[model samples]
Target chain A: MSNGAVILQNISKSYKTVKALTEINVSIAKGELFGFIGPDGAGKTTLFRILTTLLNPDSGTATVEGFDTVKNYKSIRNIAGYMPGRFSLYQDLTVEENLSFFASIYNTTIEENYHLIADIYKHIEPFKHRKAGKLSGGMKQKLALSCALIHKPEVLFLDEPTTGVDAVSRMEFWEMLKKLRSQGITILVSTPYMDEAALCDRVALMQNGHVMTIDTPNAIINAFPVKIYAVRSNRMFHLLNDLQSIPETEAVYRFGDVVHYLSHSKTFDPLSITRHLDSLSHTEITVNQSVPTIEDSFMLYMRKSDKFNISQHDN
Target chain B: MTTERPKVIEVKHLVKKFGNFVANDNLTFDVKQGEIFGFLGANGAGKTTAIKILCGLQSPTSGEIKVAGFDVYRQTNLIKRNIGYMSQKFSLYEDLSVSQNFEFYGGIYGLSRKQIKERTSYFLEKLELTNEANKILKEIPLGWKQKLAFSVAILHHPKIVFLDEPTGGVDPVTRRQFWEMIYEAANEGITIFVTTHYMDEAEYCERVSIMVDGRIEALDTPAMLKQQYGASSMNEVFLRLARAQSAEQ
Candidate 1:
């Protein structure tokens, strides 16, 4: 446990009748880039709050860099840098002023840790004189990241830094994170984007206040229980209904241009799918064995979890 | 011979300037009736400015534009009446009940009480939320709220519906379901003008236009764009265009 830079032991939190997190357990090692991959209301924010010492969990304990979140909150706060989901900086203050203010609160000067944020800061350097509110969305994100690193904390927690950002900017933000990781900082980030899960060293797929699976992105995809076929035809719109009608079909969902069809049996043949679509008067029908992505795994896990919840209700 | 569909959205030499900043510059495009047209761009790329103009929420400095066959400048009210809009930031009233939110939006669109009651029940049943109709809006899950918001947006049965990042943070299953709803609406001849950051959703559109630094850099079908850019997916096409703009600066 001492080797873990951040550790949570059976953490559980609830808001009135709603269970935000239930029996969550995770351990993030030092200098490792970890991701909490889930959608809204998946308890990502609540888990982050518990780790950052902002909220007390109803059960269990968490530690950041060997400091207990509850008993040693003062020390934990000093070594933990957190960027909330929303932009929480002062709107009236200029970008430069905001950075300096954050540094001052930690009893440190921006110059003392200038190298820590030098890469990200350069992107927003030209807009230092502008008010924080006047900056664009991408620029605001860069500035927020720079402020979080200005104090050079031992661990960083970023909550959905690229939630609404464009594809190009998101790519750039992940690059920044990799650079930070190379400098030996333990980083824990959360995102609703499944594609981003692949970029992390390891990810915990969460849903409904539970951790469905935890592993590297490749392992998670390889562990998918059933085979998935990418099916497409001339009539793309009708493909969903036609595929679902097939007796072997277990689940069907659209992925970009093709409809990803899962079978109830693991030994399902791609030829059968093509034959089914061909009989429906569909032309240019293509059925290919596709690789399961993190998204595919996430959806499968979510379905299993839903069935489990339903069975639990029955009992 | 098949008849050609009429153009529902037309923009020629559009321009909007705020002081020295040119938010939209010389944009021109046409959308056919019942087409799912995607408007995509990076942050601060002027997508919002152009959408505001089309939605009749803001006046363009100089543009010859028509939405739903109404002039953008002179017939703003008429255009507003013919279109529905929903954004991620503002969609429904969380303080009200699920049915109440529908009633309020329906009333604002000038529907009769009887029409509101009938449509509310109809949609609630379709969403399988008939039992939860009296639940508070804040109590429902985010995915349900989003689906409800979309249903409410089109309750007036407008000629066009504008969606701005409608599936931002929903689970993958619900996100796909939301797109199914969109497909159903489009099948009924309701024009869809949507903006999203998800490249997969961009591929779902009949045609997509990507903006970079206040200009439409590329506009074509997903397959055509991929071939033109020598990319395998829409995500590559977007990164190529947006990254080139930043590199130039």
Candidate 2:
């Protein structure tokens, strides 16, 4: 983690008895477009809060830009921009007002760093006078990014920045991130969108308060240890249920209009599965093998890691 | 979905102003009957403001707008009864049970008791939420809540249903299922007026209009928009457009 702008070692946080983070270890490289990919309550927000110095980790040590997360909270906050998962911008303030307010809080003015946020700021400048609450999803996102970049932070933590934003704005926001990263700002974004996992230079896969894997998106997808298939038919509901009940099925779940399943019995035949279901009055049966995605990898790891955790506990 | 579909929603020279700032500027568009029309824009581009005007929630500074054969300013109540709306927040009472929320929304829409009962069961069965009807709204998962909200919005059989970022934080699997439900709704001849930030979701719309600086920068089918912007995905088109728009300023 010597090259890292943010580092965490065995950081754990819990709310009462419910553990939100469990001994997490990770390092985010400087000027890297890193992503935290996980589901809700997977402790992504918790981990981010600790790194951004918004919330203290219950245990272990963390650092941002070589500054201890606890000992140098102000120093870290000064250099790191954080866009929370929720819509945290001042709703009453107009777009420009929110930007100026955030810049003021960080002891800067929009003009001082206008070049840093110009790409995003220009989009919201016309609405600079429009109340934040009245702005649309995409507008709010641009304004948030503008505020986050006003101080010219060395690192940026975008907690699902694309969430609640329109498809077009979501895309544009990532591009802005790329441009900012080119300026040597380390960016760490978290998103529940699997397709977006491809946008990051690297990602940490999280589930159930634990880190499953962290690597390049391509490498993670390549490491998927099973043959993935998208089994589909006209009777999607029936096909999903029957696929789940198959004896050879290791894991069967509905993904979109298709049933995505991994085979425990490697010799399991799609024809037989389709035939067996077709015989049971399934309609328009169609089954074909498909490539594995990050979502599939996450599910596979979730299952294997659940067993691994139990085994480790037994020891 | 409508073979002989008339323009259900028409907006010509639509302009909405909040104080002196122009939110929507000389907007023009038409939503055909049964078409899934996507209102797309970067944040603060005024998609929601335009939507609010069309939905009769906010008054437009000036424009010729007709929804469901009624003028937006002169006959808003008639338009309200003929259309359904789902906000980004997804209007649902957390304390109310799932079924109770359905009843509440349905009653608010003026559905008779018999209609509410029949529609509730049908919707619950369709979404597989019948098993969780007794559960409180907050207890149900976000994905289920989204599905239930879509269900309740259409329970009265509105001619058009407006969905604002309906699948914001749900997982891919759930979001995909949610789109399937949208497809089913569109198949039922329901015009879907949706706003989304996801390129994949935007691709599902029959046509999408990209707004920047209170104007329609681009408006066409997803494929056409992508081709015009010389990008691989709708997301890329958005990035190029936003950057270009900002560079001009």
Candidate 3:
């Protein structure tokens, strides 16, 4: 009701006995790049489906571009483009055919909407005649995005668009999205990769059908409550197990070659941890205090939410 | 440490072609034992074709290749016996119980009944999944299933293991745990040959090779590759190479 590009008020959904969403409230501004980040089975897809008018919420209301998802669904559908988490375009159809088909559905020609998807379409232009099924992973993602944008929708919903894409392709995909946003399209993307959260203007971190936190990636990361240290040793396999044995170590998770040791004590000394690893016969152990990234903040939030939910259930 | 490690795999002038399209063009590389070797490439960069050839899944068009100290051409059966393979997609039967899947794979790998039992218990206990061993694979979470898949892959004590994007779609914490498992395997003298799209993971490997347009465009430690390309990260290094290839095309 506040005239945001998308608004959800106490939206709740359930699939049989499983609650998929619980009192979810989020507001995204016009032309903003919004991200929904969580792991698989975090109800990200369910929320996206409700917003795109593909599915209905069991309670409360949701709107996209000022149109009600349930009542004015047809109107919402007309102005929204959705690329599902999984590939959904016509596999047997050529890339050009798929774009034309989507364009025709909106009562327009591909040439009329070419400008909207020109940047993305040009990548797949060479394979325009190739069957969609034969396209490479990165090429198929481009094709799907092109088809979705062929109708020139005012809002775009991309669910896990870069889930299995390569690092370079992922960067290119995000660049394309940024261009679309600059052209005044409101975008809501969902992804499981926490690193991608940094690319969004705002992100909602969700788990177990609940929204734990929503803010700019920097704000969320800045609000991390604990100290995280990157600790590495010549013996990485044994380093993890030995670090986990520390009485003060809260969490020991590996990040590439180094293990991130989370501690609840702010007065923690790096030398003490290194000394302990050194005693364990580890060589060249290096422990450095590190700033928290999105992943670290997410883990902290997820753990806190779980504890809160458990205590509430007990009461 | 590297000087003491022996070479477990060697490929010389590897060439694989489908009709006129060259999939892998004269690729040559050596993977050392007990090292995590990263095989990186963009999609459709012929990574899959080269991996297929290495696993003896397909006959190379023309190449001198050896895997696990056995010739890939005439001694494929011997080569296959000394390696483990896992892909991004779950390979375990959904309906089968965890123990059942382990047993099935054990039979295929020619493990003795006694050996299978010991290996199954050791792995399940190591992963803290002993209680869930009787549950069907469909009931387990994806992170647990992936860990289980990796455990089953190396149950036969293969000298080399090939992981094809084994951590795709998993959450970051789970991915971290999966890599820890990988490090444990590598510590046991298992040569890990992995293909991944995640750039951060390339940094984890002791050595990495980036394939571009069916050729090994770069090969070195992640630090060396980044330095050579004048880049900040493996992602940047890959972009430089991939963009160059696209410009040529």
Whole-model lDDT values for every prediction: 0.91, 0.81, 0.87
Model 3 lDDT tens row, A67-160: 9999999999899999999999999999999999999999999999889888989988988999999998888999999988988898999999
Q: Write the per-residue lDDT of candidate 2 for residues B1-249, one digit (tens) a residue.
A: 227778999999998887899999999999888788988877778887888888888778998999988899988899899999986585789999999998998899999999999999999987767778899887666656778889888999998999988877665555666776777888788999998866667766778888998999898987788788788777788777776776675
Reported per model, the fraction of native interface contacts reproduced equals 0.81, 0.39, 0.68
- What's the true lDDT of residue A48 in model 1? 93
| DockQ of all predictions against the true structure, Cα-based | 0.61, 0.21, 0.44
Indicate the residue-level lDDT of B188 in model 3: 94
Candidate 1 error regions (>4 Å): A307-315, B1-3
Model 1 deviation from native, Cα RMSD in Å:
2.2
Q: Write the per-residue lDDT of candidate 1 for residues A1-315, one digit (tens) a residue.
A: 668999999999999998999998898899999999998888999999999999999999899988999999999889989999999899999999999999999999989999999999988998899999999888899999988888899999999999999999999999999999999999999999999999999999988789988898989988988888888899999999999888987889999888899999766777988888889999999888889999999888877767313111110
lDDT for each residue of candidate 1 in B1-249, tens digit (9 for 90 to 100)? 226888999999999999999999999999988889999999889999999999998989997999999999999999988898988889999989999999999999999999999999989998889988999988988888888999999999888999999999888888888888899998888999999998999989999999999999999999899999999889999999999998998
Model 3 lDDT tens row, B1-249 = 447778899999999999999999999999999999999988889999999889988899998999998888888898889999998785789999999999999999999999999999999898878988899987777767888899999999999999999988776666767887888899899999998877788888989999999999999998798899999777788889988887787
Error of 2 at B20 (Å): 7.2
Off by over 4 Å in 2: A1-5, A9-23, A39-42, A57-81, A86-155, A165-186, A193-196, A207-210, A225-315, B11-30, B60-64, B212-232, B236-244
Error of 1 at B139 (Å): 1.1
Error of 1 at A45 (Å): 0.9
Least accurate 10 contiguous residues by lDDT in model 1 chain A: A306-315
**Candidate 3 chain A, poorest ten consecutive residues by summed lDDT:** A306-315
Q: Which portions of model 3 show Cα errors greater than 4 Å?
A: A16-19, A232-238, A241-247, A274-287, A305-315, B230-232
Q: Candidate 2, overall lDDT?
A: 0.81
Candidate 1 Cα lDDT to native: 0.91
